[model samples]
Target: GAGVSQSPSNKVTEKGKDVELRCDPISGHTALYWYRQSLGQGLEFLIYFQGNSAPDKSGLPSDRFSAERTGGSVSTLTIQRTQQEDSAVYLCASSLALIGTSGRAGGELFFGEGSRLTVL
Candidate 1:
């Protein structure tokens, strides 16, 4: 019955450091997605997982960005070398598979308060 959860709510880091942010999706939801929203920017798709298959990393800005889903329930987005440009709100969403149109059955996504990353 739990919805998606992200940690830290806010992260401040120096440029060129590494950071890992966590996300927990709702139970029974088989599809998960990660997106980033920079200042005055729209949501940018980062990566997505569907079951045990390879993730879609097409949207990840650079090699420094990566993500993984564990036990098909939780996920973590990692930035290898934090940059000022990476500072933004990372959002996670989940949805049911049947006719899965990106959002969960109530697939609109119950977003976390967001881990606002500030790379100084």
Candidate 2:
């Protein structure tokens, strides 16, 4: 893929259902990020993965939210027991390097159109 790719561009699930969102980042990119944006709200950081370092999951809202990156390329975010409040646009982004590294002020990020999840 030429850019970040996310699956199931739109999903409507009943409350308490489980949903999995997938992201495939640009080839050779080392950093991947997951963000959530609710209606009329700003993007909320969910998780970050950089190379082999431990993923920064400080932004996960609860134990019901989890994510994993495999082979350093693909990633998946799982939301268990989804609630109406969980409805949002889940975005995935990839960067070649971490911000402020490699002489770059802030590395550029390639973002996917995002997966819109709606819990009814």
Candidate 3:
């Protein structure tokens, strides 16, 4: 019955540093997602992983952002050479759907409180 869990609820780093954010999804959930929200901005899709399929990285802002889901349970989002513009709330969500198609059909996303990142 556990929901998505994110670690390092808050992080502040110097510009140009590298940071890693972690996420653990609910059991048996085959779909995982990463999103980011900047100040005064709506949530933006970052990446997606479903089952053993290749992750969708189209949403990542640049080459500095990347993510990986291991064993289909835990996922990590890494921002290399963090920049001021990268400061935002990183959110992780999971769903019972095996594919992203479920959300369009009314499937819901269980989200974590989000990890706030700040680059000074």
Candidate with best lDDT: 2
Model 1 local distance difference test score: 0.80
Clashing pairs in 2: none
24 Cα displacement, candidate 2 (Å): 0.3
Predicted structure with the largest TM-score when compared to the true one: 2
Clashing pairs in 3: none
How close is each model in CA RMSD to the real structure? 2.6, 1.5, 1.8
- Candidate 1 lDDT, tens digit per residue, 1-120? 476888878999999999999988878867777888999999887877886443467889999988888898888899988989999999987766622454425445556667899999
Instruction: Decide which is better by TM-score, 1 or 2.
Output: 2
Which stretches in model 1 have alpha-carbon errors above 4 Å? 98-108
Model 3, which residues run further than 4 Å from truth?
Answer: 98-107
Candidate 3 global CA lDDT score: 0.88
Q: Which ten residues in a row have the lowest lDDT in candidate 1?
A: 98-107
What are the models' TM-scores? 0.87, 0.93, 0.92
